[model samples]
Target: MELPVGGHPADKYQNPKTMKTRVIILLAIFLSAFALLPDRVIKGTVTDGSHTPIAGVNVSIQGGGSGTVTDRAGRFAIRVPNLARALVFKKTGYKSLTMPVTSDSVLNVALTQATLKTEELADQILDHSKQPGQAEKSLAFNRVAAAPATFSGAVMQMQVPTESYKPINENGFLSVGQQPVTTFSVDVDRAAYSNVRRFLNSGQMPPEDAVRIEEMINYFDYNYPQPAGEHPLAITTETTDSPWNPGLKLVHIGLQAKTVSTENLPASNLVFLIDVSGSMSDPNKLPLLKQAFKLLVDQLRAEDKISLVAYAGSAGLVLPPTAGSEKKVIKDALDKLEAGGSTAGGEGIELAYGLAKKHFLPKGNNRVILATDGDFNVGISNESELQKLIEEKRKAGIFLSVMGFGMGNYKDSHVETLADKGNGNYAYIDNIQEARKEFVQEFGGTLFTIAKDVKIQIEFNPAHVQAYRLIGYENRALRNDEFNDDQKDAGDMGSGHTVTAIYEIVPKGVQTSYIGTTEALKYQQNHVRATGDSDEMMTVKVRYKKPDSEKSILFDLPVKAATLAFEKCSENLRFASAVAEFGLLLRGSEYKGKATYADVIQRARAAFGKDEEGYRSEFVQLVKTAQSLDGSQETARK
Candidate 1:
């Protein structure tokens, strides 16, 4: 303090006391200036143009290097230094936004994804063409359209690629005299119904591959008798005139699993494996998924514990195992989730399985609830890879359940594969009401498995049935030898789940166009059934395993040659047949003979007994909507 660097000697000495006072004044001024420039906690959510939360967005005060990136929920809380007039939000694929900071505590921002100008897109395509093997990738971004676009007028509907489904090859009628037995796995999935409903509600016909008639019929609740004995399920069979083809008889086989009380349900260790990728930024995806999970949270018992794992570019555990009683804490974590980045679904699955394994509960319901649009692009994206991954994880005794969300780019084939291979059930959640139906009203059926590897084998009586064809389940048919193989995987049946399968059968003497005739085989002789079994239509054999067992138990039911008229059939049978007919019409099936929307409506209405829950009523209305969309006559063939 002898002499300041830039000060005179006289100035240093003459102001010993005065200089001290001046220094105090200067210190006070600096302290006051520092006090005026206080730090503020700026908190906000970053979303895209669709108002979907966007993660990994860079948020910072203007002219400041210090900033924070948004978490998976698109929320950020950063302390900003003084003299910052505005906040800038930046992300690579989105347009950078500089918003005025009117409030120190809160600022919600919406950013738009950066779309290339026509010229820019053209340049990118041109450049990509010069590079080897890049043409397809470039064209995917700028594909040819059916019509010229007026870009300034309205936003054109973008063509999002979807997984291709194999064409539906209708099951052919097998000769009862030649091949008396038909074996197939039971399918309890209801994705086809909800997905078809989505298309119809949007005034578009669903693709043929999307219309699984068996699933559509099974989607509705049938008042089938519950199991009265030791078996976990009850089987019932009924026959009536086929609504589409009157020449053939519709055989309805129903299996209803026994219901368990909520108190009796085992403690559940659930992992909510959610996809928070950019593709899930749509309202119907991540947002709807949140609401759906909230409903599920409400149904959780106090003993249940839940952990949440989110995946975007990579997977991360957003929340640790939280007691169901700490619902507020769980929901708060859920609320913080935001959608952005590429999808890494495979990583998410591995992480979810890891958590499920770590928290494995003996005799407890250990499961993972996967909610996604099925856009697994980043790591291990292909179906085979995913199936193998799930297959390996399934051996750990942890079950999985997939809830599909969103449209356009939905990967039904992928999600369906995961569910089928993972020993889980697949369902599509089209709306909040559907969510309530799955998570609240049918929670036990959707979450608790009572039977696994449920297979159905029917031995037709040659004396009664001339030929037979399963109406749907084209993808679920199993080889006769595989039906008894415990190692061969099949569909699972959940508690209180009702599965209905229909077969259009031709009586021994009846004539039909579906009958396939073949020359007599020289290598083998076909033995005709004796007349003593003339009254037996077929024998329904069901094989299933306990939830924890490897060996299967078998049950049998003998169906008679029922001649019940369509009008004389039970409401359950009639309604299920009507649904099958609707599916045929939707598919424009080759066998849809004399099927009209009017007839479908009439049959559905007549069978809409006890319209509790209004599900049947909704079906009737959906039929009317389809009628309006396709006209009075069936335009499905169009």
Candidate 2:
């Protein structure tokens, strides 16, 4: 037979150099055939902060819309039009990179690893491990990380990569990769692990249920105080016996943050502090944020004035204080913003607050809306400095509202603190819909402050109730002393925003006990006490200061009999409880007992009252994704 036109399979396989040369020749010939045609080849390598190669990275040309993944050697190549301007590189667990495609085809990119706290790792381990007990152990280790250190004061840093790593023992040591092995350790007393195990076995997780209570109360759509006059703030409390732990009763408290509308509302002087940093170049960041603000701009009246300040490596006032009626001017200023340069967030806040004070509208809704990824690279990099700065600004009568955007390098803790100190609200905008929920749909409630330093304190009648736990306010809980302190600011409630809180209670004479009793009160008198016989269980107390007031007004609502039917309560309570349980699981709270995604979904589905916004349905999807992640983690753990 005649020799093959090209070459034998063995020849092509064995003589790889010759085969490569032949392929190159063919490609060159093909390009030469179309001499005038414009073509380009963009190639780059992706590496970690340490300059170590990271394989399987994704590289894409922005406008060209073509993409490829890097090989084992971290090299990626993509063919594009010669006029192709730039390319973007992205990978999980690392900051994305983007660069212009200049004459040099070879480009090297370094991606910074995202920071993860031990608590976050615990969440990941619980959600991603494949084994049954592994998640529980990882959760225990995380708790140990948070325990008070009995040894030296050195901070123990822990890193759990998105990719799975080997299991860590009680001593807190794990290895990953062959070349650069990573290790972690936490300060644990001799009996710490055993103590934690005992606590778990005793079913005594932290009083996390109390924490959730505050968040649930805060998350409701409460009616706010109108600018008209002082009115009686109303909150309704409904309770029922718990199904899981019959000894504990479930109480739902709903607060309506309402304000009577006055003929003349206070004039609002608002400053829009926007981040134009390079990291915010993503469509979801600056573009979506701009769109979200436009909705708010449309809701503004003639009494309102808005100023714009933008920062990226430098801070500048893009627009002078202008009347809300001048929509064109504001829109043009917003449209001119372009993302580039490093983030100078601290400077941006300073400039924005300065502008707000310059045009301060006393007795009005004076506020600075800070929208960013919470990434401050320039001066005042520490959270304390930023917090102090915000505190000082708040003294000038301008409140702060923090809107967090994007994903990588998101500083949730920092944003939350800033909002807390500035006497404002904090919200994360994950999509345009949430933006509408924050800005357009809830414009007045979002921008106007009805009540400030609002705190809830409920004293249960020990005779009627045995024990109680609040749900979902782990970070927001105020110390008992901080409750009455006027200077100690808490959360703000907006007009029309509802706040709901749940407390699980146990009735006296019940056979079960959720919490162990401290040796019965010593030396108490044995005087015969009359039993009221009323079904009343507890009295709820709420204290709040007017937006401009220093002292707080207290309100009380008494909850009497319990209801067993879940059908009587609004869907909001049931749906909120599901989310609360999900958060508890993510934190691996000691309180979680036999709670699963399945339970959450079932509860949510049953209580999913007219979900016109579809938030409840979306919650189901999130639960599913979390469940899948949990399954994967279990597998890995095994």
Candidate 3:
């Protein structure tokens, strides 16, 4: 019963025009104030009480719907209403934090570790165990739930770990007199490094099978020459003394693809195949997935196109092929996604591939990026069918890029197999920073393929090198005959990608006990040694096909013997040596001669040359952590 603004109580009762005018004036004032309350992007870093960055922390605007999670680097960027009062930062086993909203663009937060309750541990632990023929991977959800892990100031969880990793037997020495050729398919995937890091960070030693040394070595960028002529890749070689053993030589082979600037990169027609199953209900899986993809959406150009296909109990196209310029629309769809129901990943793949083909761009990037925890229950039955499907689709010129998320029930074998057969690469996104690295920082290298079916064959001169063993890549080994078969499938390299391989070699004159004498056959005399190529240690031959071509081109380089001391080797060799040595210790390889955590720490510190992203620095920290844990009495080495 109050009088209208600017009108007496009696006049308000007598004049309807005055009341209407007042109502319009008041509405204009309210709208003006509301329009002035624009959204602002807030950037920040979250850390624990120790000041170490904490990944996977949920950051949300209080009383607002917008939210995001911290990346591996503990950094996050979120858009919030200007009038928001506070932000809530939360992570399991950490005390929840709420800080008043401020005008500052950067907000740094630190949360203290909390004593975890049984329910908390039950909800937080990420474990997925698999046994052969048991279908543990596909049947993970149906089994009874496991117990919670013991907590100790959040240092390490005491629980039965269930992550799946295929058994990897370290390669041993091969006498050049018997086998003179070393061949392997090139592998550009780096998922192993991040996955292994996750294990260490969780205070557990990574299962030996999870350590793919070639993938680890290739994760970091090394300075190498670019392709000069018709080839899309350039080669570099280095040799030095092996750090683990005396008198043994180590050879480094590096391939660097030509760098194509963003402006010159081809238009992209992309399909985002996502998993929204009940297993992905974990915050790190589906929720983090949505945020991770938003980073890619932000990088899209007007010419690029994006489509989204989500699968759970079934598969459906959430967003049709739309221009990348419609970023808001794409991101809105991403934001609306929720996790529930069983996974029908196989059907999702078919739909995604079909869409990619339908919108396929000739002479451009046509790809399907699958985001999932690798739990495909309803759709794909076994890998044989999955591989056959992906392989067929890839032949249609639509490549796959797998972005693995979540932990429990993760089917790494399936992820790796899909990437391998589909002529693509795989990466595990443990946090938001890693997503940015994939979708923003290494945008070109993650999507655009420059070469396919890339393979390497090295002919060792027995006269100079007596024995050699490839440091890693047990799974990528190819039959010598397969190298020459153009129809054989191999790893594909992306633009600006680098692949490195190392070999531990024993010289002809070096009397190494590891290469025990092989008795000559009584019926067949040992083949005579060929010394014609004694001038060179090995001839490194490479074969690769263009993105659109079926025929592969051949190239070769004769590498002379290296005489540099281990300490005097190039930074590339030294760093690679450091990483390889670390892998050796992690895998507990029989060949980890004289390798110690101290040596790895020192060597990595010296080679932390151009770590612009702090990855090398993080490696050093992980090594130190492993050194600490492995030294604990409970984990004493034999």
Report the Cα RMSD per candidate. 11.4, 15.8, 6.2
Off by over 4 Å in 2: 1-232, 259-265, 511-514, 523-534
lDDT, residue 429, candidate 2: 66
1-638: candidate 2 lDDT, tens digit per residue: 34465755546345878888999999989867766576778777887776756554667888757666664356778886765678887754355677888888788888775443445434544553433212222322221222111112232333221211112111111111111111111000011111111222111222222122243224434323322335434676667655444445678776676643533457789999999987677655787688778877887777799999999999998999989899888988899999988889888898998888888877788999999877777867787888888988886778999887754345555666688788787776654556777787667667777777777776555456555566544455566667667777677776666666666555666544345644444332131123246566666777788787889887666777667566566665666667666655644555555678798889878876666665455456445545644443444345
Q: Identify the candidate with maximal lDDT.
A: 3
lDDT of 1 at 136: 36
Model 2 alpha-carbon miss at residue 187, Å: 33
TM-score of every model versus the real structure: 0.75, 0.65, 0.83
What overall lDDT goes with each candidate model?
0.80, 0.62, 0.82
- How should the candidates be ordered by TM-score, best one leading? 3, 1, 2
Local lDDT at 82 for model 1: 61
- Cα distance off (Å), candidate 2, residue 566: 2.8
Worst 10-residue lDDT window, candidate 3: 141-150
Q: Whose lDDT is higher: candidate 1's or candidate 2's?
A: 1
Number of the top-ranking candidate, with TM-score as the measure: 3
Q: TM-score of the candidate numbered 2?
A: 0.65
lDDT value, residue 132 of candidate 3: 21
